[model samples]
Target chain A: MILRPQLQDIKIIGQYSGRVILGLGLLMLIPLLVAVCLGEHAAALDFVIAASFCLSAGYVLILICFTHKEPTWKHGMVIVSLSWLLAMFFGAVPLYLSRHWGGYLDACFDAMSGFATTGLTLVQDLDHLSFAHNMWRHLTMYIGGQGIMIVAITFLVRGAGSALPVYVGEARDEKVLPNVVQTARFIWLVSLVYLLVGTLALSVTAFSSGVPAVKSFFHGLWVAMAAWDTGGFAPQSQNILYYHNFTFELITISLMLLGSLNFRLHYALWAGKRKEIFRNIETVSFFISIMLLFGLTAFGLASAGSYPGVSSLFRKGFYQVISAHTGTGYMTIHPLQFVGEWRALSLMGVILCMAMGAGACSTAGGIKILRIGVIFRALLEDIKRTMLPRSAVVMDKIHHIKDIVLGEKLLRQVALITLAYIFLYLLGTLAGIALGYPLKLALFESVSAGANVGLSCGITRPSMPAALKITYIFQMWAGRLEFVSVFALLGTIIALVRGK
Target chain B: MIGKNFVKIWLVFLGISTEIMMTVFIMLCALGISWLISGGWR
Candidate 1:
């Protein structure tokens, strides 16, 4: 029987969601302070108005939906799905008020992209955008990378049952610590530590590369946040290319790699389990996949005579492949270079990397290394089973933080998620092709959007059809959540409408 | 708290170092293979 949510269930969900929105309002203060300090009065006013609206709306929801009952697991998941949509709506207030976006829909698109850490932007005149607005853009990446519910869980939510469902709903299945709140705190601890070290290293590099000291530090911190979070929004339109320093590129690359690592792996390593890095299935799979893709991309570039020399191939080709593989879209090359210069084979290599993506429970988006590792192991298990005697037993295991036996259930779940990601990628590609983009370019952009890798090939602009924009937005949202939460949301809506 | 987590701090450093080293090693191998396939020393 299809169970429909009651009004009380909806109220409980709203109550919890209000608390998260209120937390988001508090987060907006960081950019507001930046604006006030920089004397961007107009931008400061926009943030002020937006923050006030968020706080007021959140308060109103909490007041209206006040409930003494604890949220059920279903309520937690529904709240998380609805909270993200609410966050996108409320988060876009300042961007819309700035009048830099084409319309309210475009503002919402960038907001979702930012919160998803997808990095595909629709902002117009990003270069001239005020410091406050720019800070908010990168701040969304930091907030989103940690999972907005994580912030609420760390500071606001107290109940373990409520916290676990929202955490899982955010596409993070592994808990680094026994307590969900402690796991959320540990995630923040790791990110904060990296934020400090990465920003300092990149700041020095930027300053040494002749940028003014203050601008260097600001840009350094912004880029580092984007990189380490695997959120590719750049303060400037030119992205990593604007720096033009090899040192900067290397630092960002290191950060991206760190960002793509599973948080559970991070915990195990931090606990002095140094051998875990080598033994983990995801790490081994990532290493092999990256190397394989890198070779293909380099060969394609060489055969096409696209890059003139070995240095260009290493700098442009290898860097881009790694970025896409990590689901970090900080591109040193221009968007036109992908469409005009990169060969079909090279583009396909990048598309594949983006589709495969980084580790599960990490900031990156796509099918994830964990699933890929599981699928590969499942295939090996099947092969062994076929070769062995009928009475003989075959067992497959993968070491994450610990050894986990590969079972039918695990294989089925991994395959299902992988299929969903492929379907989402194809949906966006068809939409792009229908809008008159070439098949290759359409496929590239669609994969980029669907994988939450922001490497564009000159197709995503303000001039594109609104339908395509909305389709890509849907793709980004569904891809980031890995389809389960989105499907749950759809199921709830259908039950409400069609249930007897 | 930071001072108490000294071992963890050290391991975090080691972890990052290992990642960088692995990345460099793989990139070099990829470059060498690509160079050979594209007709090396031309």
Candidate 2:
């Protein structure tokens, strides 16, 4: 029997959701300041209106749903899912006001894409986009990559006990520190340090590429945010290719791989647990899988004679493999070249890498290396047990931060999540195929959206069917949240409508 | 005190450098394998 949610539950969820919204409203001021400093008065005004609307709505919600009680797990889950949807709407305000999108829906799609760190874009005249709006777009990736709930917990929310559910709801379950707040701060610390380092490296590379000093700095900062978050937005429409510098591509690829690593692993490494890098299952799996996939892609492209020599193949083909594997989607090749030039085998290799993404509890989405590693170990253990005598026992353990036993419960959970991702990929593919896309392109785009890897096959544009855009949006949101929070939201809605 | 802080900073840098080195090595390996498969040696 389902119990209906009480008024108190609603109040708790609403109050926390309002706090998240208020925090988002405050974030807009950063870009607003950027616009003012750049003397983009028209763009500044758009942010002003959008910020005011967010502030007022947030304030009103807090007042209407005032509560002193801390959020329970249910309240936290509901708040996270609800706040993400609201964040998409509010975040889209300035984007819509910029008059670059075809409609509010297009803005919303881009907003959701940014927040989910999915990197798909639907804006027009992207090259001519204002500096402030571009700042906001990349900022969305930074915020979403760190988990929006984390920002609120670090800055706004007071109670640590209440922060855990929302933190877990954002698909960040591993706590690097003992306390949730401490973990949030630690996550921020790691990101900030990397941000400083990554931005400087990219900026120098860009400057060497002959971009002007000021443009190089901003471009470096924006790309650092996108790369560090594994959110593949670039300042210019050409993405990393605009610089045409191998050094820049190398720096971004390094950052993308760094971003895809588990934050806990970063903590361990920073704390001088260097051996963990070698012993860790995720890193080992990532190395093996990337090498295997790159081999496939390289052979496929080689057979097709897509590139003339090994140098071009390594430069273009290897970059795409790593980009896809890390879910960064920073394309050197144009989007159309994916379908028009690349053969099916190469596309399949990229798709597999996107599906088997890097690191659990990291910014990169998909089934995650941790789950894949565990499942593989579990299969080996089973095989060993079968080959041995009936009385023999096989025990398998894998190292993350520490050695974790391969248990049936863990395997079941891993299998379920992997299946959910496959289902999502299939769902988005069906949507695309229904709209007259070819099977290969549909599957590629579907996995791209569902895995939050923003690689496109020329199908994502302003003119894509409205339904397809919405489907991809849902896919990005659900994929980023790892289905737990979205399912919790759905269960809540069902309880509201049909509960006894 | 400055020396201690320097060591700490150096350790952090070293940690990041190690990760980057590992990434570069893996990428080089992948590149090398691809080179072999694509008959780059030929």
Worst 10 residues of 2 chain A by lDDT: A307-316
**Deviation (Å) of A310 in candidate 2:** 1.9
Per-residue lDDT, model 1, residue A212, is: 92
Clashing pairs in 2: none
lDDT of 2 by residue, A1-500 (tens): 98889999999898888887888889999999999999999999999999999999999999999998898887888889999999999999999999999999999998999999989899899999999999999999999999999999999898799899899889887889889999999889889988999999999988887889988899999999999898889888887778888888888888999999999988888877899899999999999899889989988888898975777887789889988988888899999999888999999999999999898878898889888988888888888888889987667888999988888888899999999999999999999999999999999999998998899998999999999999999999999999988999999999999997
Alpha-carbon deviation at A263 in model 2, angstroms: 0.6
A1-500 per-residue lDDT for model 1 (tens digits): 78777889888888988997888888889899999998999999999999999998899999999988887667767878888889999999999999999999999999999999889899999989998898899998888889989988989887777788889889888889998988999999989988998999999999998999988888989999999989899988899999888888888888898899999888877777878878999999998898888888888888899875767777798789878998889999999999888998899899999999998989999999889988888888888889899999766898889999887898888989999999999999999889899999999999999999999999999988999999998998888888888888888888898876
Top lDDT: which candidate number?
2
Cα displacement (angstroms), candidate 2, residue A118, comes to 0.6
Over 4 Å off, model 1:
B1-8, B23-42
Pick the DockQ winner: 2
Residue pairs that clash (backbone atoms under 3 angstroms), model 1: none
TM-score of chain A of each: 0.98, 0.99
The C-alpha lDDT values of all candidates are 0.88, 0.90
- Tell how far residue A399 is off in model 1, in angstroms: 1.6
